[model samples]
Target: MLSTSARLLRLASLLQSRRHWPGAALADALDVEARTLRRDVERLRELGYPVEASSGVGGGYALGRGAALPPLMLDDDEAVALAIALRAASASVGGIEATSLQLMGKLDQLMPQRLRRRATALHAVTLSLRTGTPLVDAGLLSELATACRDGRALRFSYRKHAGETTARHVQPQRLANYGRRWYLIAWDIEREDWRSFRIDRIEGGLQLGDLFAPRPVPPDVAARLERGIAYAPFACRITLRLQGSLEELQAALPLWCGVIEPETTTHSLLRMGAETPEGLLAQVLMIDRAVEVVDADAVASDIGRILARMSSVFSRDGARVAP
Candidate 1:
């Protein structure tokens, strides 16, 4: 026979595991009398679980929503998944690192040795490269995520790259992460077009307004966000013909590094942007393969200067050396 406290915990776990449990079946499962089961249900109610009870031939117990969050009961797989996610979030999502780490520690303490070993192995094998991206407030992320989920209109101040500030009202659609930065993809009311707002650039409080009908977002929101970051946010655009597989090109560069299209089975077209022609040229050179300039009108001079420097360095005895 289980003790009172042990029985209560088992009862709670059983209640959480299913939508409904008949009184007789529940008592049978717990190996308890009907009168004792009634007392357990009362105990759960006092603990704010909102466990609803119905009497008669079809009477049973069901856990319903309460005013406050109750203690969660997670199975082995769910516990491991949550631990891994919290660990990743600690490194990727800014402003929540400390909180995530704290939660991760608590979870690690609660997890069994088998689950803990799996979580530890995953963490040991995975590496997160920090990109020095600007920190976004966790509260702001929560607000935006809620707005996106509820189809709410959000009004917030935004800071442009040129140090200009403007007010924006948008219908929140999705929150995406690219290269360590978080972006909010939404329909800008004033601009009357889809826009990607860097979460870090959103200034002041976010005001959630009346609910709006949800709009259709891009099928591949991450790809759309990547393009917006690479081209729309920069001034100097450069297109190059890179001699490499599209998969290889994608793996070599970050998603926001550029947009790539398959030119052939072994070649790809890469379009990228930067604030300056030199900056754009440098990014093109980072690809570890032969590259042909498809369009060099903007960075011709910069490319010429770089070639000249390389020529001088490789030359010996006032003669250009060929490699």
Candidate 2:
């Protein structure tokens, strides 16, 4: 039999691992009788863990929200994974570096020397390549995530790309990340349409409104987010008639790359936007197939320049023999 302290730690770990545990199942896992399990649960409660219990056939135990955070026990792999994630977050996520560092310090203090070395090595080897992307407030991201999960209405001030600010009431559905930026996909209550709000552009405080009847969100929230991003206004919009299966095009392009509509079994229409025509042409070339331009006038100059460059590089007079 495990000692009292060891058994209590084991029970606590099990409770934290899942949302709920049936009384009998928990007792069996702990190798203890019902009475002993009850005592262990009571002991955990006394230690500031809000362990809730229910009665009857479907009765189970759950760890509820407590007034203060409890010390969590993590296995070796979880510890390393969390450390690496925090390190990455410190680089990519805005406004939580200090908190992440403090947590990392605590984790390092608790971890054994071997695990600590492993985490340190992983952190040293990994790099985040994001540059110039706006940082989002971590607190706002957390608030938005919680509201989305709870189906709560949110009121906040939003700044548009043209620098116009307006108050928005929305039913937040999901938080999405693309191009190293965070976005909130929500139902705009006043506009009666779906909108993607940039987290960094959300101004002031987020006022939590009453619980809302959850609306039907897109089946693929990530794909929806990508479409919204791709279709947003840009300096240049390029359309191409690609000769390939829709499935093949989707597999080759990312969600944010463009929106592909099936024209036929062997052809698809691709609409993408980029700040520069050159960039758009480059993306089209990356498709690695001959594509007919739907709007040739828009990108004719870009195509001519690219073809000229390619011709110059492969000109017969430029061929050289190795000495």
Candidate 3:
């Protein structure tokens, strides 16, 4: 037999599972006497769940709408689904990592051993990855999502890649999450062009203006965001001319590493960015064979020292280093 609190929660769940229940049927479902069920209903009403009782031929009890949102219940499947979804939600929110750990533990404890093992494995792999540096303001993300849904025009100061801040008037269209970051694809009202703005770089809270009719979102939204995320927000732009097809180079490099273009049947252009010229060289050196660095001459003075250090390390031993 369930204790008083547990019985009350089960009773609440039963009341919520259907529109109405006959008094005797409800008592049978709860494994309690009719009087005990009435007391439980009264308890729920006192807790602000407005449970209405009807006593006639078709009489029973029904959960009526409350003035405010009262606590609802989730069955096992619903609980597991929500828990899994929350794991992938923004890890960038400050302090949520710890809260997330606590939530995961509580849920895991409630699960049967079979399910708990899977939950344990999931948390073990996800904790470190989920709780690092703070990126997106969860509240701000909600605001942007709301703006997109409401077709609202937004005014916010956006920080550019070069550390310059500019005011923007945008018709909020869509919010894109790519490469573990957030991007807003909207009509730039001032520039009169479509642009992808990284959400983290927005200066502050958005000042929402009057709602406007939504414009047609481009079919290639993800591609545009992929390009922006790959090439933008780096210290300097680096272009590498590699002797391979665009597809080959793309397969060889990470998705956010750079943007690739087909220069010809025999050659391709890879455009990427890094914080420094030497950092670009490091990425290039990752390729086994040599490739032409178009902007190499420009940064020759900067990369000379780096090349010398690398050469000294390799020239020390005639033997090849482990790949």
Best by lDDT: 2
Quick one: ranking by lDDT, best first?
A: 2, 1, 3
**Residue 198, model 3, lDDT:** 87
The number of clashing residue pairs in each candidate reads 0, 0, 0
lDDT of 2 by residue, 264-317 (tens): 999998888777777777777777778887865766787788777766667658
Better of 1 and 2 by lDDT: 2
Of 1 and 3, the candidate ahead on TM-score is: 1
lDDT of 1 by residue, 121-224 (tens): 88888776755643677888999999999999999999987789999999999888776778899999989988899888998889889899978986877666
97-216 in candidate 3: lDDT tens per residue? 567768777777677776666545665675454356767877788889999999999999999887999999999898887656788899998888889998889987789899898799
Residue 255, model 2: lDDT of 64
Q: TM-score of predicted model 1?
A: 0.71
TM-score winner among the candidates? 2
RMSD, candidate 3, Å: 8.3
**Candidate 2: 10-residue stretch with minimal lDDT:** 314-323
lDDT of 1 at 203: 87
